[model samples]
Target: MVSYITSTQTLSFARKPHPKEEVCGDDGAAWDDPDHTWLVISDGLGHGAGAAKATEAALSWITANYSNNLEATVRGCDKAIRHTRGVSLNIARINRSTKATDYVSVGANLGWKVQRSGIQRFAGDSGVVGSGVRNLKTTRVDLDGAGYLVLASDGLNTTSDVSALYHSTFDGDVSLAEACLERWTTGKDDSSIFVYRFT
Candidate 1:
């Protein structure tokens, strides 16, 4: 029950298992640009060295090569982690001018908060990068004045109740993000979360 930071407009944070010896490999990033804002979370398989490599590789490609082409970005990430593989990734990018968000994602589950509203949600059936293949879909959402985002791995919980969780938390505490992560996650996998809790 950590009091993770939640603010108006721009904010981001995450929690992962201790790296190295522990199999806790949580990979994540965020960027708010005049043209766009982007955030990524990749959970590498296993723990320690291998997971780190997979995560680092995926993140490097996504941030460096994210452009107008969402499909291209997905392909690039797949290719980068062909050898070391993992499931669950949440990539969110928001366009400043249009107030639109293009989410190029694969695997597990993701969620959102509209400032004062509680956490809403989304998920992928099997979004994993491997053999460096590009198998991603882009989802576009119109943003209100301000909204928050949470990219969580299945490790925290299974993805069975994604849509249900969204409808339920309409005016709850910001800590609800942590609630979803802990309540649903399996715990067997390496669980982690990268959250951009905004106002």
Candidate 2:
């Protein structure tokens, strides 16, 4: 399969509670040095301001300290919210030089993929965030084989039927990603997604 080394990112957030409840939020950024870019999504435990603040804090911390060790960053975030426990996150670091990607999660949903010609998926942690769970995984891409990194919260209700969005085609992942999130994020919890485009 042909791979891509491009990196593109897009995200969507749908307000929940059908009106005021917003359950999800996402953010991402790449470095100019080609060292790596960061993608992070944090689902606050509850709804309203409390949830928003929790998720916001998580992303802020990630971007602020992404230059450090990823595992330490994950562990640090977990320790800070031991009591409030309003965070579920998936943080990925894509390195241009090594073609290595590292992911750190805490009670968040796992990841899914739309490889150039294949589909892969991972599940979520059973418990809530702030439970002192350190679930992390790292993968290396061919830098020219894979094109996108797709991740979403469980609210999408699409655990089993993701084929419609992740077909084997040359379609841009940002477009496909937004379409899927718009369809899946309709619950009380806000629906959020983060897509990374690869070169």
Candidate 3:
């Protein structure tokens, strides 16, 4: 078996709802197989029960079929949740051997990579997954060496301060991801951030 040194962290918070509400509006999953690592973030439509249902359906498909190609995996998820409210999701895959990263988005959540060279941003197109995507794009990037990758839900502002991610020592600190999650929280809705440090 081949091994790559990689660390992952995820931060998720629920949206405040009416007194009777008891569910979070967003969900995410991250995992690594022998060959591939995946990061997924989903926001259900709206901010309560309906949204939670949509995300559950979407995540079920994502978890089961993530081994497939990025486009096909997303299409499968879309079909699986068509009966529900629908969701906005961002999916990312990293090939452990090649250090190649492929990501696709069908909603408002987005992804970014911080590398010694520069930062690469991946933004979503307009559409709700499980409903229909009028426009969308798949992005591919190669990790040169050690780098940090972040995928965030719409609750967090994309333009907020990210200087911490640029510091060279960020990757060395074990708490790097936790500090980032705190710095990026928008506090307005159900928010989440998935961090991957690949070496």
TM-score of each: 0.71, 0.72, 0.82
lDDT of 3 by residue, 1-199 (tens): 0112334343222223323456766777767777877778898887788988888888877776665577778877887899999998998888878988888888889688877677878766778989966666678888768777878777677885554566534434545544565566666666666667777
lDDT of 3 at 33: 76
TM-score of 3: 0.82
- lDDT, candidate 1, 26-137, per-residue tens: 6677765557767677777666777777777777777777777877777766776777765456777767667677775676545454444544555454656765444466
lDDT of 1: 0.60
Give the runs in model 2 whose Cα sits over 4 Å from its true position.
1-34, 123-131, 134-144, 158-160, 166-176, 186-188
Tens digits of per-residue lDDT for model 2, 79-117 = 666656467676666676675676655565546655657
User: What Cα-based lDDT does every candidate model obtain?
Assistant: 0.60, 0.56, 0.72
For model 1, the superposed segments whose C-alpha errors exceed 4 Å read 1-9, 18-23, 113-119, 125-127, 132-135, 158-186
Tell me how candidate 3 scores on lDDT.
0.72
Output the lDDT of residue 169, model 1.
54
How many residue pairs clash in all the candidates, one count each? 10, 11, 0
Which predicted model would earn the best TM-score? 3
Scanning candidate 1 in windows of ten residues, the lowest lDDT window is 1-10
